[model samples]
Target chain A: MVKIYIPADTTACALGADKVAAEVALQAQKRGLDVELKRNGSRGAFWLEPLLEIESGEDRFAFGPVYPGDVAGLLDAGLHESSEHPLFLGRVTDIEWLSRQDRLTFSRAGVIDPLSLDEYRREGGYEGLDKALAMTAGEIVEAVTDSGLRGRGGAAFPTGIKWRTVLNTPSDQKYVTANADEGDSGTFADRLLMEADPFQLIEGMTICALAVDATQGYIYLRSEYPKALQVLNQAIAIAEAANLLGSDICGSGRDFHLQIRVGAGAYICGEETSMLESLEGKRGLVRFKPPLPAIEGLFGEPTVVNNVLTLAAVSTVLAKGAAYYQDYGSGRSRGTLSVQLSGNIRRGGLVEIPFGASLRELVEDFGGGTASGRPVRAIQVGGPLGAYLPESQWDTPLDYEAFTDVGAMLGHGGVVVFDDNVDMLEQARFAMEFCAVESCGKCTPCRIGSVRGVELIDKIGKNDGRSANLELLEALCETMDVGSLCAMGGLTPMPVRSALKHFPGDFERGTGNGIER
Target chain B: MHSSGEAPAVIVSSAVRKFADTPGGLLPLLHEIQAGLGFIPSDSVVTIASGMGLSRAEVHGVISFYHDFRDKPGGQKTIHVCRAEACQAVGSRQLEAHVKTRLGVDYGETTVDGRFTLEPVYCLGNCACGPSVRIADDVFARVDADRFDELLGDI
Candidate 1:
């Protein structure tokens, strides 16, 4: 029987993968061809998504961005035999976009059936858990520490230090919470990973539980991802049935129970303290820090709070050992960074590469420039809160310290490109507007200053006391940056400030057609 | 606007009973009630507050704080338009205007016929393919003005 594969990923489904899969099944049945149809995750090459693959001998041949209408024609053109077709791209492994990537953490993504335990295990999934089950808590923490694995959710806090603090903190009932509230606008790595290879996250969280002595774990996922929510729940049940996440794990007599806690639509909940508060069934407000989450968290107990990617990388760090994973990247940033190339780019997708790669390479070489075929003007790295880099700064290497030196951040590794027609002043105004809308109202600087910031930008755009309003906007941004309780308010000024610095012409050329107050 | 004949108190009580044992059950309870009843009815607030051992004010605060929760029922179908920067890069602002003009409803407002309610969403995680929109649970990508009209016609 010929084997056929199609992506069940949300992006692919949105692009009509479900319809294509249905068409393939219908065509096979009509022809009386014995074919095995399977749903796999995206290969991160989203441009070629609904990417149909056929297993022939040892290699899987690829074709795509396939639609239902094209399925019949593809079959007529010998799709089953992987013959000449316009959509066909030969072997999947040889695809240049995927072959160039250093897929350390995303090795199993788009490669195996996400929900199949047998496929997951066959692709070297449980080896990390097996190794972790044998190592002492201190040894597990030590390996992560040695690997230099930082939090992948934006903040570059070392994962080992957080676990060590939780391990040392005395608490009878601690918690391991994975912040899956990936609210970043231009980023989706967490959602992709959880949907494609959920067991990886589960295994990573289990390891954190054993290391921190916390038997209970919760994944605080955002409501935007309904598909991911369903996938994770099913994955957890599968793991439990397989004895990987129950009262006894692999007959080790240890315990780790995992559950998914969906977040109501509050972007502030992406913050650690705010996420903890939401987990406690509160208003998802940002909490004050003195006793960090590691010291006193989740019901006033010691907690281990790590981002989804940070936790997911633990599986790789354990499976490949510290030295093997650490050898990939440069400087303090060890291991590969999952760069999500998006926005107005021609070939936007997820590019996992070692740190020290230039933004120019990602945008121009990999992304193939703007989708509109226009000259690139600005690029925003990180999510909504990240700064917009101009042409001069595109050569900056994607390292944590390197970005900081240029007043930018490799935030969540999201690079959103923009063509020359973009209005930076409008973007600056939107940044303030977004801040005002999403603010938790915890601090006056964030809540009030954001509204005032929007007004100030408007006044500048109208050219009414332009210079004075610009100065006032600077002062307001400074206040929000220094006085806000958390990053939601504090970092709100990043995009605004970067726009003012890099694209001053847009503010000067504003037609005063700003968003309605 | 409790259009359903079922009593809000009964719906609230059942939701409360189902999630009362779970840790931090308020959000889930509220979610269940909304899922079953379409919205969290005003009269059920007191029942929910008392059942969960909290004040009515607290329950209201939680519901009001989150964007997902609503106090009243929306239109028959809800259309969430992505307004974030990534979408903006690929002409979502134009799509946003087209949606409002075509539906005769602004963000958070229901159409006159009660067929659709337009809402603004920051992102739907399909950034690679921009100009995304979500109608109920199904998210559609590269939604230009023509695509939006075609999708609306399907409904």
Candidate 2:
């Protein structure tokens, strides 16, 4: 029987993978051809989504952008016949887009049956947990610490230290929470992992639990991803049945129970404290600092709060050992980044590469530049809070410190590319507007300052207040930066400020077509 | 609006009771009630407040606070247009204008026939495929004016 593969990743599905899959099945059934169809995750070469791979001998043959209308033609063309169809790209492994990637976190994303526990294990899945189970709690924390695995949720806080803090904190009941609320506009890695490799996240969380001695865990997922929520919930039930979750894991007698908590439509909930509040069924308002989430989180208990990627990376850390995972990257960012290339990019997709890869490599090489075939003006390399880097700063390496040196932050590794046609002032105004809407109203600087920021940006656009207005806008941003409780307002100044700095011409260009004040 | 608020108190009580044992159950309970009745009625708020042993003010605060919960029910269909940076990069701002112009309603308003309600969505996590729209649980991507019209035409 010929084996057929279709990407079930949301990115692919959004691009009509389901239709292509169904068409393949229908065509095969009609022709009475023996075929096995499996839904795999995306290969991350999104330009070629609905990418059909055929099993022939040891290698999988690649074909892409295959639609429902093209399926019958493909079947007639003998897709499995030595990768020799018109759409064929020879070996799937040699596809340079994927071949160039250092897929530590997303290794299993496009390779196996997402829900099949057996396949996951067969492809070196449980090795991480197995390795972790043999080590002492201190040893496990030490391994993570040695790996230099910072929080992938943008803060770059040392994950090992956070776990150590949780482990040291004396509490009757401790909890481990995965902040899966990926609310960033250009980010979908958390959602992808949940949908494609839910077990990786589970394993990572389990490792954290064992390390921290927290038996109970919760993953606060964003509700926008209903498909991810469904897939993760199913995977959880499967893990529970398989003894990977719940009490008595792998006959070790150590208990770890994980649950899914979906967030309401609040972007601020992605913040750790706000997420904890939302988990407790309250409004996702940012809690004051002094008592960090590591010290006191989720019901006033010391909680191990790590992002989905941070926990998922743990699987690689344990499975491959500290040095193996650490050897891949340069600088303090000592691992591969699952870069989400989005927006106006031509070949926008997930690019998992070592940290030293420059921003130009991601936008120009991996992304294939702007979708409109126009010159790329600027790119936002992170979620909404990240600064917009102009073409001049595109030389900066994708490492955390590199971005910071350019007054930018790689919040969640989501790079949103923009063409020359983009109006930076409008983009700046949208940032303030987004902040105003998503703000929990917990702090006046974020709440009121954001509204003021919008008004000031609009005034500058209309050429109403000119230089002083820009100065006032800068002052207001400073106030929010210092006074705001969390990054929602604090870092919003990033895009606003970056736009002002890099694209000053766009600010005054809006004067002719005066936007309503 | 989706389903009518005929038995809002009953809906609220059942949901509240179901989640009574769960900690921080109020938000989920409120979500359930909203799902059932389309909008949480004043009567349901009182019912939930009593069931959760909270004040009406508390219940109202929560309902009004979250963007998900609606004070009044919308039209038969809710067309949530993506308005975030990714979507904006691909002309979602223009898409928003087109949607409003075509529907003859603003972002938060319902069409005169009660067939469509336009809502501004931040991001639906379909970033790679920009200009995503969510009509109920199903999220459609790369939605232009033509796609938008085609989607709402039958409904």
Task: Identify the leading candidate in terms of lDDT.
Answer: 1
What does the TM-score come to for chain B in model 2?
Answer: 0.92
Q: In TM-score terms, which candidate is top? A: 1
lDDT of 1 by residue, A1-517 (tens): 8899999998999899999999999998888878899999888888888899999888899988798999988887876544778888889999898998999888899999999999998988988899999999999999999999999999989999999999999888999999999989889899999999999999999999888889999999999999999999999999999999989899998899999999988899999999998999899888899789999999889998899999999999998899998998879999999999999999998999999999999888899999999999999999999999999999999999999999989879999999988999889999999999999999999999999999998888788888899999999999999999998889989999999998887887444543322
Q: Could you give me the TM-score of model 2 versus the true structure? A: 0.96
Interface RMSD of each: 0.6, 1.2
lDDT score for candidate 2 against the true structure: 0.87
Off by over 4 Å in 1: A80-82, A510-517, B1-7
Tell me the tens digit of each residue's lDDT in model 2 across B27-63: 7787787778777777677777887888888778877
Docking class of 1: high
What's the lDDT for residue B84 in model 1?
94
Clashing pairs in 1: none
